[model samples]
Target chain A: DAMVIQNPRYQVTQFGKPVTLSCSQTLNHNVMYWYQQKSSQAPKLLFHYYDKDFNNEADTPDNFQSRRPNTSFCFLDIRSPGLGDAAMYLCATSTRESMSTDTQYFGPGTRLTVL
Target chain B: AQSVAQPEDQVNVAEGNPLTVKCTYSVSGNPYLFWYVQYPNRGLQFLLKYITGDNLVKGSYGFEAEFNKSQTSFHLKKPSALVSDSALYFCARGIKAAGNKLTFGGGTRVLVKP
Candidate 1:
């Protein structure tokens, strides 16, 4: 099936260490997004890539960065992992159009644990 | 600020009974609303959306939602709830100016007792 896929369903990293989560999509969607979802909280948008243009959320922390090396692959890099950064990282893809409602498809998500 | 709100933190329903999940939104201009479901340890699955046209929109898994512009509400509904329907439900609104970014609600956990 054409779907979004995430690697390392569970990840463990030491505090202040760098970690990377990966995502890929077979849907060929033009837009890819990364979101941070804490336990019992709504998934918050961290950043997104519309083609090669990166759009970061205004309130996203500096420690969080993302790269879309290509259309099918995107990576989320945590410069320095913190306890607060331990959360489920979700990757989503969507086919965007001018002035249209686009439905985003999501991956299973990576559960990050900062020790 | 554009936002979506799920009033209830959790909803309990008996199997085979009607299920209703409430959602309200505060956004500028015409609202584009959506409903998504998330199972434990999994990503969210798109259920339904209302951009324009009919007030009632039917979606995956026998689920439907009614969009009320006057009430600024889009509530998800199911005629007969199933045990498998238990999960976290979220309400979201699309922000056109923000590259059609989705602003999601806090989410409501649905519990359908068999």
Candidate 2:
């Protein structure tokens, strides 16, 4: 199946320790996004990669960064994870079109636990 | 500032009963709406979307949403609710000028009783 996949479905990281979550898509989409979803909360967009162009949300904390080294893969790096960073990290991909009508496909998500 | 609001934090419905999940939005221009379902410990699955055309858009898993431009609402509906339908539902709207980023609602947890 051509779907989005995320590594380490459950991640355990110590407070102030750096961690990385990985995602890859077989869909071959040009646009990939990263979202943080807290318990019972909405999935908030952190950043995305339109090909090599990385776009970060203005309100996204500086500690979160993303890298799209190639077309099929994207990585979310937590510089120093905190307790508040404990959440489900979702990776989604969509075919890029200027029309903005395409729907996004999501991975199963990484549940991050910062202790 | 585009946004989506799911009025109820949770909705309880009995199996085989009709269900409605209300959603309202505020956007600068024409709205592009979407509905997604999230099972426990999983990512959201796209259910349906309304960009243009028909007011009633049918989507995956026998789900549908009605886009009412006059009322600025897009409510999800199912004729016969099932126990497996229990999950967290989120409504989202796209901001074209914002690089197609989707602003999601707080999410409404749906509980279908047997």
**Candidate 1 Cα errors over 4 Å, as ranges:** none
Interface RMSD of 2: 1.3
Q: What proportion of the real contacts between chains A and B does each prediction keep?
A: 0.54, 0.58
For A67-115, candidate 2 gives per-residue lDDT tens digits of 9999999999999999999999999998868545779899999999999
Residue pairs with clashing backbones, model 1 = none
Candidate 1 has an lDDT of 0.93
Best candidate according to DockQ: 2
lDDT of 1 by residue, B10-113 (tens): 99999999999999988466688989999999999999999999999999999999999889899999999999999999998887765568889999999999
- Tens-place lDDT per residue, model 1, A1-40, is 9999999999999999999999999999999999999995
Q: Which DockQ-derived CAPRI band holds candidate 1?
A: medium
Model 2, range B1-114, lDDT digits (tens) per residue? Answer: 447898899999999999999999984666889999999999999999999999999999999999998899999999999999999999988778545788798899999999
User: What are the clashing pairs of model 2?
Assistant: none
